[model samples]
Target chain A: MNQRDPLKRVLYIDLSRKSFWIDDRVDLFERWLGGIGVAVQLFKEEAPKNIEPLSPENPVIFSIGPLTSLYPLASKTVALFKSPLTGNLGESHAGGRSAIAIRLAGYGAIIIKGASQLPLYLVIKEGEVEFRDGSALWGISNANTVGRILREAAIGRGIRTIMRIGKAGEKLVSYAAVITETYRHFGRLGLGAVLGSKKVKGIIIYGKHSIPIQDKKKYREIYDRLYRLAVGSDAMKRYHDLGTAINILPLNYIGALPTRNLNSSRFEGAEEICGENIAEKKLARRVACAHCPIACIHIASIREPYPDEPYFYKTTFISYDHELLYSLGSMLGVKKIDDVLRLIDTVEAMGLDAISTGVCLAWATEAYKRGIITINETLVELDWGNIDNYIQVIKYIVEQPNDFYGMLARGTREASKHYGGQEFALNFGGNEMPGYHTGYGAIIGYSIGSRHSHLDCAGYRVDQTIKEPPSPEEFVELLIKEEEWRQILNSLTICLFARSIYNVENIIEALKPLGYNYTEEELKKTGEEIYFEKQKLKLKLGFKPEELKIPSRVFETPTPHGLLKREYIEEALQHYIKLIEYKTLQ
Target chain B: MYVSSHEVKRLAILDAERCVGCQLCMFACSRRFGDGGLAKSAILVRSVGGIERGLTVIVCRACLDPPCARVCPTDALKLRKHGGVFLDQTKCIGCRNCVEACDIGAVFWDYETNKPIICVHCGYCSQFCHYKVLGVEKTI
Candidate 1:
């Protein structure tokens, strides 16, 4: 409410002009708050209607909330961009130092626009922006190497975020990811390809500043309360114990695992890549974000025996979670945990979104099995669980040795469109599917949600737990409510892992000392507003509910619940449209 | 060493191996001084390279006869009872002499007002340290 609000200032950078400035948009922050709520408004203003996703006009908006750096688990940075993968509203959240750095760097949001003529990496430090030449760093295949080079070049340590792309982004793979802080990522919906289109290699932001709390005593009280709950809660405690990969065995046992391109929903080799196995066999270390007490980032030391040397082996460090395990392990029929780890490592190094890559490969393998194509088209044989051949295909996807590999690099939707296999492409709204195959909940959530992301709706929880099967209309209504509620989480950019602790009342209370006074009713209204605004943005961008593709494989596959019927899903979709229309009229 | 010290109540890295690099200590230290952020944090935790190798918890060693105090041109940093340096901010010119003189790089600069932020040997941060990597010990 005051002119001294440093957190309200949004840093704007124009790569084409090589110009940068800070815009004090206190009014926007006042009305929308920060993170996704503010980011969506900025994206609407910056990205022209129906702008090509890879065009210079598309904007990249990274935002953190007032709670950032002031509380535990307020540690996620929301990135909003037009997805090159989906061609719709794009949003992703990443942890590590991204939020902490941006918040401490003294900005509420950063909006980068326009493509540069030459390769450059923007460095923000000490209240200034410098476009460092990235010619030498370009074409370096590994994302880790890019992070390393940038880390050395960047001045500030302990409080800095280094975000960069790798071979996939450089090659304009539609599902490329932007790796941040080496082990974390803005990993979904082709944010990296969008950055690649701008000719920007990466961004390094570092600063030393503080957020001004309105009431220090109340702040400390709330901080300790939240910290205690965060560490003490049983449900939340599992995040650090086995990490999210703990879901593998349970999900597989329940028959909701989505193995081998959804030909089956359970995998036989679940234990090999399951959480307990990975933790006991390979866990190298556990790390946390700057302000978070939960060290959820689990890195594994994957040691592989050399082919030529009988006794020699090489160890590689790779971060793994449920999504990668599902996408690369069960989904691909990768029997060996080391094989899944190696594939994950390859995806990380190449900066490819593992979900899309695995889904694309799965679709290809199935397509090949049905004689949709031959070895002449795919230089390497497309076989399930064949790590050797899959590894070659992954490299081929990045390098694009042939037409099939090039189409596969684009993503599942495009690849299937070209070579046949539309029924089992397994992409929702043109973005690759996540690791959930619960039932209608996951299907409706992924197909009809704002970003077409499971996190947006998280209906898998509803599917896995609900005893009574609700009506199709009720299902649609529940998903809408779920998504609208998640607007608050993504808006605060809080990690969904801490959803139980970040209840609406707790959120409102958390905002008080951080200088935001919001009532429970007001927060709910704000969440609905953010949700509607994103839906409106997507509608403007040609995302049509009527045209939403429902993959038939989802219907054929028997989930933990039962067979998901196409007719039932369509009924839900129809109900969802009517509900949104009614909300719009109101 | 402080000329009149009887017992040293200084912060110690009791076990660096226990650190998960959450950096709650940084925010806790800053909060103790004033606000709830890292601007005033004197202690730091960073990965040795990647997080795979683990954390390097860097803090003022609370050196006996601290070089930061010796290099203070304005005598702004006086030796504390626990072997750390305490800054008299009114006397500090923001010349960064103490920041440069510290070999361990524990001296942090506050960018807003441009002053060297140093730990005063308080163990307020150790309370928030869930990993128990830090402690307040009475050392001889």
Candidate 2:
């Protein structure tokens, strides 16, 4: 074990006792190599089998890699928990001050368990942990306001991370996000709701511990090489230019946009609300994570006038990314860019996962139009592209004013279960599907993924670009291979944006200077092991890989590639099921 | 007390208007000392309140009188020829007098070694500030 790094400290906090303890888990660090690797292992150890996700027994783990502060683009923190949305293994990664702050704070991972009796906001500076009373902050109107309060109260202003939940999390909106640094988040799988259930409102991590290096010259050489690759690479520039929102126009152009309940693949108003127009018209600023040179976090400034005052206006900052655009802008049939920004802003303030929230509202609107859901149930006339009504409905979802909102707050899958819209529920596995409806890979990836997330496999990238459609067996193989490799990325917890630059050759080289000497084959084997561990967690929970569902809407609508035959999806999913099932025995 | 302001090179925050708050300059500062991480950083960047407003870069202002030097009981915070001060670790008693002395919060403390970390005016951090929020200048 390369115990050269003293930063491999695991901090455990028990909310029921309101006590914290630190342990040196260098063994886990050496095996898993940190980030998702360490987080999933901690989660499996602490989270009891067959325990409900929202219960006190569930564990929330945050882990960053040993290569985190030592390298550029190693700027993501892996968050693992049991999913309240999918009722299975939950994994989410976030970048900002989060990864660097946690790594510098002298910890490889943090495992928090047990529910608190009272509302609590954890304050962690360097090593000391203080459980601050968050009674005043609970049920705050906006998530931003909670961040503003913690930003001032916490020490180490320049180099710190503040992760807080908003009204949605407070109400336990099933897909509520644990927002970090205002813009970034552990955005999927209801990590925030798990925290809310524990009566924990927010967490602040501050640290500035010096890292010791064995070989200084080698460290500089690797750092310079990676940094140059990041800045010089055209792939990275795409993120800097338009961020992930760059995908909107291209995906729309390809007729795979998933517009308006995915009844149509192409969005007619894509030109008006696409990345180019937004970057040209409304881009307020671009920000980066601590070590990342690529400033992909794009903010838009939208000015709206007061109702009464002729000239009085309020300028609001709304963060935009590919997922938010697809979910709110196209999926909801929003035409105006400002309207999309407004919806994005509403979800951000409410602390909801914009993707799931948008999909839920889309289904609700379709269900209402089809007479499945009545006006009394919705409390409003839910319509397509109706921004004003959508705003009110989002508020209702967060507030959970009635039985309908409460059911919808659980997620699209749960909502569609009670109502008669399972066909158009548009959920892959139990989690609501992301923007892509491209091909077999995208469909199977979402349904079969451990996290039920697009980031897990990124099969959409393959589905959209490949010249020939991959066969059902080939498609399942693509997902399996990609998921395994992604385990490596998530473990290193490098930003997905820099995946191309940090190839296997570079990853093996990068690990050397950080005192983690490993061969390429060994790294591949590690990824394989990490993938099975996540699969084990999923199988241990209620998720059956064979029981994965193919939502009817995906087949009903034709993507740019063509109408996806039910046989193709079923065959591909079967192949994946067999693959995972065989792994359990070994 | 005679205020000594000598002619020498120093790093200064030029304009924070365009700062994106990457904190790469701080990484560069720590790297200059043959290590990684912000424990030994001489410069710092933070949001004014929320990140939407941009960032404020806090480095050695190269103070005219140098309050950090005046409060140093063991002369650890040596008054440099420039506006800032140089920290001599051997002389530092780790009492943290200089950390409290700087009203601008330029003095960063290293809890590991129990000493105040001051800027050496090497200008390494300024080179990495892509936004040019920081610059190296001659202060007489």
Candidate 3:
């Protein structure tokens, strides 16, 4: 009860015994600064390097940063675990009431360990933790339906976070994700499968306590300034109106939108499922995380008559984004918005990652055409923009009906290896490729990023400079530097979209009002340290950048700039390995 | 500067569709009285169910010749000429009279003070509404 607002209070949940306890570890919060910073330290301390990601020994750590719930845009929560798919350090970030609720619940982080005997849900309110029976809610198809049930069952409606797994999670799909608050997600590296392995159906957390501020006047001043800037800014307005789906047309036109298993960089029918189209034709609503001014999550309501019966109609509310549009729309040759929406809905209902699911399907389609997977053996024929087939295929992936579905559910790389099509696997570091097909930077970023993610290094953000390309050595160093600093922001749990507003200086100033004291240099150093710790974990887990396979199909396809030679990519990756090794030595 | 209930004034109105649930109005209301949090806030911004369902902007609608002030148990709730009812937090016991009397349900209760807090239509929230969701006008 005497704990400071931001200091670390660790909530430990033991699923095997159905017991939980809170332990205050002020040192953890004080030194690492919470979120990924604390999570990496904890991951190193608790989870062994040799443990299987889906095993009971693998610990799931969810942490929020010091600035979370204290600043306007610092509303993200970081979830860290060993990836079920990648077999390396796994981390995912999500926004919603998750961060705010975790902070307000008076805990810096929640550490979940040991698999349960039966389906269960953990409900945390204020300082009390309750283990609720979730047998009735197990194996639910729709992720949002769980939200409604949790909303009614839990105490907090407007203030709490409801994070749940769907059918894909229940079936232990390695690429499944944990969906929170209907739209937000612990999106990558199979966190949902981890939760499913432990039989945790959902976690609902809520708290209502006033936090202490360093200076009330100063806090109010900074809060007001950030609030005004966030609400009135043109950047935020764009996000509010069209959302991230706006990136579709521009990325497609610029030849960076990743079409047809990433063999082609342009999609001819990009406009049909673009952000503008979604906004004008199908956008039913927009939602935001707790305290976020920019509500970018777009939900579309589409009504159609039943296939068997004309009299009865089925109305489905599906969420859309540029990444999914690229992966499912253009990549799968899905020109019709309704087809793409249905495909996305199927993925969401099963709780599989839309990007990974689409890319996996894309790889399967290519593999099928090449006779690697035959129509007789498959549940559905893999084809472009075939919603009916896509729906059946997703269900099969979730169910892991046969050897092919089981391998495909693991990810494209494993599936490709099993089916003999490594040339078009479309995976980097065992994870499916994100929707960025920009040159060297994105490729190098995915190869070396601590989390093997697009947002980790944001190499695509500086795609323009990669036209001429940098020397292999220079590129790796620059990528490391950028990724390290980004670790700092993500640890702070700040939304990346607000990067312009909450620059290092602004972040420091903003944190001062909330009782944090650190110079920009110190913060950056902390971030670098955190990033290196994650690298150490990956190295211990037998990760070798030298061994990563760059799909051969990329070399044959000439991009907008020119043909991307395979040797250049190899050289860059070699440089990456050397840089990481050099950093480790230092 | 002492504007009483008899002084000539105006009222505030809000278009709910324009509200982004920024909670700026709640902050502005609490700030005017020199406090923070939902406890002191008069205007409330709560989502109808989820964020995708939009928001419900709850505040005093300022009924023509108010009934909340007239039905006050201990003469604590008073009619402000600017619009709506104002409560003298120190004057009344926590009786649930004015709460039921109002049709629009604008009378907000503060748990800490054990008193009803009503919007006075001073329109301080407009300063914080960067989206221009609120409008304040004078009645001739």
Candidate 4:
């Protein structure tokens, strides 16, 4: 920790008091290494236990890392606050201009506490912050247009970050996401709703200041070496070529695509939704982060003909990813490219999480079939690859007209409980399942991983490697190591796909140019310490493994390998919990 | 290999309709400065809405007879024949006159240096533009 970067200055803004102050907790940044590490420490300090997530007492903590603006793919800014959805630790990371802007604006972190009486947006320039009225932007249904208006009004167009929530957040939907730069998002655990609770419409920030480097010459040398690897690597090639949608065919071929609410693992029309298909037929262009050479963001154009008007038409561009394809495409039985695009657009317009939205719709569809929620009670029919009806359902998820739809807005777990379809709720830790259906690693990782995210542990890779299912102990051990290493990667704030080209030694070398003096061993230990700290914070905040609910639907359907027994998953979860605890002790 | 000035240089123009707002060009531009951060970069990339609607990339187009240099109060902005304006930070004041003069708003200001950070069109940012979103073709 002696050779660590200077502590980032913390900016605390109290909406209730309409005041702001700075806190330079150097020790916290040096000890934890920023992002989740610092955020967790700050979260425990600011947001005490038993406070309502949407209350004035709750604090929303936004954090970035030391490597931000100094390294490629280290563009994600992590948000940590109590969840409006799970009533637990709600953390989401987004890549856009957010991380670079926050770092350049001269702060490592910002904590917003209390609630404003009226809707407002905060603008941070240089070292000063301003509170502006957002009455005009209030209740805007379209999230995409909001970003454009803010962009036009801001001093820095490309360099600044404009984070705003749409109707879903304004409505206080538990799955609402904070949209940044349009394409990137802090998409899960309802950070949008948390912002809405504070009556905060948006955050606009931009700055141009140099980050003090320890060794200028060495920093340049090391940075160039890693930069070349990131921009030129084979792993990054596909991302640049087609983005994340490329995983569709490969994942589908492996029988891990999760089609039709887990009833089948493979989608018959998987090729149509693959990255290659989108790139060839629909892909308009590729995009990247402020300091990232990996332009992995893919935008697709969907031109639709008017039903009645002649020669009058509108073209809508939509973003595609593996999760969106799995949830809205395969899970909902959507096959047509246009249909999938429309569904994704609807989700974004409503300011909802596409993965969760798709999963919720899937659950409702199955529930309707089982005589749970009647046809009249639901707004739209849940048919696979049905774009028009799915769009209507997405709108309802945000608006939540009747009691049934309102209950469903809370997420799959809450919706399933009320409607008696807990068996196939398709959620872990209150967040809906991601696209992966690889095996034990994916399930166990979702069940026990900190964020209940595929990225948290990425156990799917482990499952893909094993021909025979590993024993419960073996599976648990593999996930533990994966999660531990990932903790290090996240702390470094680099994208996980660069794991092949950049190892611990390479990362240390990369930082040497920036003037960080840490050996490979030191880096590993640092990663381990940060990982344990996050777990401890989660546990202290009341995260319990025994209390996790496993949806019954997964057990009934046979995955690609074979039928998944309830006992196997339970056994794996039990071992995984113990392993996590054991690692924390170490 | 000599090129004439009369022909238009087929530089990669960003069709905002196709943009995903990824900002990869921003990082590529920052890399040209041989530094790690967005502070020194000339290019800008940002999202429209959750990526589906696309992104916007902002950089100097190297305008012919650049207005940034013409309106400079302190002779800080200098126009080059090829395109773009070279900014002399030492001679300049932080007046932002050139920023207002340039119709495209390509004249960027570095807050820390209190000077304009215009694009030099060094072609290094093009190396990272693997998508071919940026092209550095010669004018005939």
Model 3 chain A poorest ten-residue lDDT run: A1-10
Interface RMSD for candidate number 3? 3.2
Model 1 has an lDDT value of 0.87
**Model 4 misses residue A409 by how many Å?**
0.7
lDDT of 1 by residue, B1-140 (tens): 22122455788899998888899988888888558668888899988876767789899988888999898889999887757878888999999988889889999888767889888767888888888999888856
Query: Which candidate achieves the best TM-score against the true structure?
Result: 1
Output the lDDT of residue A364, model 4.
87
lDDT of 2 by residue, A1-586 (tens): 3365756799999999988999999889889988888887888788656888899998899998877887888889998888888888888889989988888888888888999989999988656889999999997899999999998887878788999999888888899999999999988989989999999999999888778887788888887788878888999999999999998988888888999999988999889888999999999998989888788899999999999989999999889988898899899999899999999999999999999999998999999999999999999898999999999999999888889999999988889888879999988877888988787778888887778888788888888778777788888887878889988998998998899999999998888767878898999999989999888877888787776777788998887678889998888878888888889778
Task: Please identify which of the two predictions, 3 or 4, would achieve the higher lDDT against the true structure.
Answer: 3
RMSD of 3: 3.4
Could you give candidate 1's per-residue lDDT for residues A1-586 as a string of tens digits? 3345577989999998999999889988898888999998999899666799899999999999878888899899999999988888889989999998898888999999999988999998646899989999899978888888887897877789999999889888888999998889999999999999998899999977877777788988888899999999987779999999999998998899999999999999998999999999999888898789999989899777899989899889999999999999999999888889999999999999989999988999999999998898788778889988988888889899888888888888988898889999999999888998998899999988887889988888899889765988999888888888888888787889999999998998888876778888888888889888888888888888888998889989998779988888889999988877777666
Flag clash pairs in model 3: none
> Candidate 1: which stretches are off by over 4 Å?
A1-3, A305-313, B1-7
Model 3 scores a TM of 0.91
lDDT of 1 at A169: 90
Candidate 4, which CAPRI tier? acceptable
Q: Write the per-residue lDDT of candidate 3 for residues A1-586, one digit (tens) a residue.
A: 1235634789888888777888878887778878888888888878765788889989999999877765667889999988998988889999877987888777889999999989999998656788899999997777778877887898755557899999899898998899987778888999999999999999998864445565678877777888878887888888888988988888888888888887688888888889998889998877666667677778898888978976899777787877889888888888989999988888888898988999999999988888988986476777877779888998999988788888889999888887788998888898888888777778778877877778888877767555577786787778888888888888788898887788888888887766678898998998889888878878887787778887876666655556677777788888778767888877
Q: For every model shown, what is its TM-score relative to the native structure?
A: 0.97, 0.96, 0.91, 0.91
Candidate 2 CAPRI assessment class: medium
